[model samples]
Target: SLFRILGELWPIFGGNVSKPKLTDMFYIPQKPYLTVGTLRDQVIYPQTREEYDELHDSDAGLAELFALVRCSNIVEREGGWDAVNDWIEVLSGGEKQQIAMARLIYHKPKYAIMDECTSAISIDLEGFMYVHCKKIGINLITVSHRPSLWMYHEYLLKFDGRGGWEFGPMVLPEGYQQGTA
Candidate 1:
């Protein structure tokens, strides 16, 4: 149920624009009754159902979906549903980052570049997102300073900060690899 809800809301949360065809994405084969509208109604409010449903039927829905997923918690607290309204402007930095991520996921790009995109998020949340990305087979090029972030990547590119750089397979060092150039 949660997965269905996530699938329907993902485009809205991610602000996708590339037009999702059934052939491009994979859906878990199970109950054949789960439509986008059913998923939306389950996770979102009934009053907001029409708006969420309308988003799936149009290209511009991607942007609107992104706004909703990013601001949904805040909007729900204040009793508002419109993702493009005044609520978006007041979201916190972390919330904004989440919104940006939601947009990217919605777009479902063949390749994604994450340039310090999760700087504002908690480490656990970032890890969770990365796992999801991997599950979906979205090729990601992530740039982050956090050592833990490297665990998600298959390769590593290190800049020595002295006009030198190294790129290769990631190796876990037995001890801190330090040198002065």
Candidate 2:
């Protein structure tokens, strides 16, 4: 499975090396065609030929898988490797939320359904994720009460105080339009 491949190669690709257990969160592909070292060699530059050869020789297949997983932002945080090792069992709600989002994106799904997935993240990170999704051209269905979330959405589905709903393309709030004019 893709997840298993990612799990095996994650350490080689400079991923959250401390959290070996957490590697399972990635979605594994059905067939094993690539390795961690191959991916690392393809995407990142090794300081020396010796380094590349070492990675290439060390379970090359898994190395490729890890390289792909390492591409996720959540896996590349400063001190993230140490954090995953020390706090894997005691991660905060926000950390867990971020992990789940990373797993979802690892597979590059055609469509995503996010039910308040960003509730635990700061507004800035939430905005960043939305922008990333847009750049990737992934269709998203996000559900959240935060007004700021609407800024990243192309359409809005609002539920009125009454037992009614309104659906339409998103419009800039009146305040924003007034300032521009």
Candidate 3:
């Protein structure tokens, strides 16, 4: 029954989505799914190529954001901002995560839902990123197993996978000393 329904719907959706004639009017609403790994794409790809070119052409603090993520050298190493169009091919996993964090910082959303966003990032850099996020007033709802992240968050939510869960103020592990500024 489901296959029959899908087979009927496929003809309708498939033609419109797979190939549209020049004059055919078709619109498909798409909801973007962005995760920690795809953050670099968010920063690199705008709604249009013109917007991306304009962003680099203009003094819109792109350099500062890159510096914030320790990616300033990437532009220089890659020959220029133009080279960043192929970030996925050129950047390392850690670098990609950094770029994603930078994108989050750039948008400055009031509340960010981050799931293991900094898993590839080093503890020192992760701390720096968290500090800046707090400084910029972006609240983080982070999902990570790393105990190093406790100092940055005010609350904790833990799921035991066996239908058990806990939520409360962040509890640091033993001998964890948050350093003074």
Candidate 4:
């Protein structure tokens, strides 16, 4: 599936075939974790500790990023922004994905590779997230079987499990327009 495509594509993009450039791109698997660091640490990645310190000191910027992902309430709900020790344990799957998306929005990477990462999220919210990401110029390379996601993307990079793949513009339904859903 998509993982295989990513496995081979990672090296050309930056790292070993199995891993991509962690510093700039967002890579979310079906299962995500907060063990990488605190919520603050997760979103401010690629930024130096000094840069994180600057944004943390400013506060509003970080809060706004969370708000953009529809997760500002969770910071307080889970005890506070910087205090969530294990976000995966405290938050649900959808919440974890939202956090990942928040990081993407904050970083505004040119591209992201997601593998069924938003499986737990409602379609409406997922669509909103995609729209917002597109608005910020983030090109998504999503790996999902959900046709519901097709409207948000412009191309299809299909991998046929048997060591073959195809790439082309996405074909939408008759009378359906991109980004209309």
Candidate 5:
């Protein structure tokens, strides 16, 4: 199901991709397929309402998640965590990205392909996303050219655009090398 989503969304910004199969992938696809349910579902996506209930979902937990993503104000303004509306109509770009990060952290998949998912997010929230992924031991493949993100990686793969590429330990500007900055 998610592979089908990859097929749909990848072409918008990614290079060509073949039909993905479960066997060929490194990790199992455990994240729920994105769905439009309640406001809570927005943050714990791919999970059905029944699964959410069986997992003992709580407003306190949802509140904590909202706080971590720096969007609890939305819930506060909406009256409470139970307020379910069209978030897409209300959320800003950065807010949407923050929600995505919250969903990713909640899912905590073994592997994630974060293709510039944080581009719309602030650096602080982006850092939180990175830190949370590390804490959960998620193997992250972040596709971005933003220099600020270079510090998070041990290895760097630079493409020269003429079909040439360089893969080695990251080499960044002074005060920003791995383990230094």
Candidate 6:
């Protein structure tokens, strides 16, 4: 069914989405799936080349976001954001996840559902993402088995994998130590 739907909707995503002729490629009235293929594409996703050009003839703050993710060496190594390549081929797992987090922060959605999105990120940087999202007033319904992640949420909901579940206020796991500033 999914393939059939995507096929029917292919006109919207057919060929190069950058072509202005495809603008009339059937209206869906809502956000559709978007790909995060490149560093720049991740930041300004769903926007075609012309759309992004409308926002900037120059570069954006990708360097700063990279630094925040503790993965700032990309821009210098690749020459700049303009140095496009198959990021999936070049980047490590953690680097890819870091880029994903940067995109979430850039989008600043009101709510987010992170399903093991931080699996490859380091614990420290993972916590940084949580804190940053909280600071930006974004709520996260994170899906992780990392006990340390519980501290960031207001509630905990656990499923029994049956027709049952438990939901309540946050419960810090045992031996959890708050890092001193």
The best candidate in terms of lDDT: 4
Error of 4 at 34 (Å): 1.3
Instruction: Identify the superior model by TM-score, candidate 4 or candidate 5.
Output: 4
Task: Score candidate 6 by TM-score against the native.
Answer: 0.73
Candidate 4, run of 10 with poorest lDDT: 7-16
Which ten residues in a row are the worst by lDDT in model 2?
27-36
Model 2 local distance difference test score: 0.49
Query: What order do you get sorting by TM-score, best first?
Result: 4, 5, 6, 3, 1, 2
By summed lDDT, the worst window of 10 consecutive residues in model 3 runs over 22-31
Q: Put down candidate 3 lDDT per residue, 1-181, tens digits, no spaces.
A: 1122222323443433342231221111111223322223445433344665555665246678888877777667766544435455657777777767766676676666566777887788888888998898877666677777889998877778887888899878789977532
Q: Model 4: clashing residue pairs?
A: none
Q: Please give the lDDT score for candidate 3.
A: 0.61
For each of the candidates, the C-alpha root-mean-square deviation to the true structure, in angstroms, is 13.6, 14.1, 11.0, 4.1, 5.7, 9.3
lDDT of 2 at 143: 67
lDDT of each residue in 32-73, candidate 5, tens digit only:
233344678787666766787898746677777778888888
TM-score, every prediction: 0.55, 0.49, 0.68, 0.79, 0.74, 0.73
Please write out the lDDT profile of model 4 over residues 107-167, one tens digit for every residue.
8877788789789887778888888888888878888987779988888887788879899
Error of 6 at 155 (Å): 0.6
The TM-score of predicted model 5 comes to 0.74
Q: In model 1, which regions exceed 4 Å deviation? A: 1-71, 78-89, 175-181
How close to the true structure is residue 103 of candidate 5, measured as C-alpha lDDT? 76
Q: Give candidate 4 misplaced runs (Cα > 4 Å).
A: 1-24, 46-49, 175-181
Compose the digit string of candidate 2's lDDT tens values, residues 31-126: 212222322222222224466455565434433333433334433452332222433344455655554454455444555556667687677676
* TM-score of candidate 4 relative to the true fold: 0.79
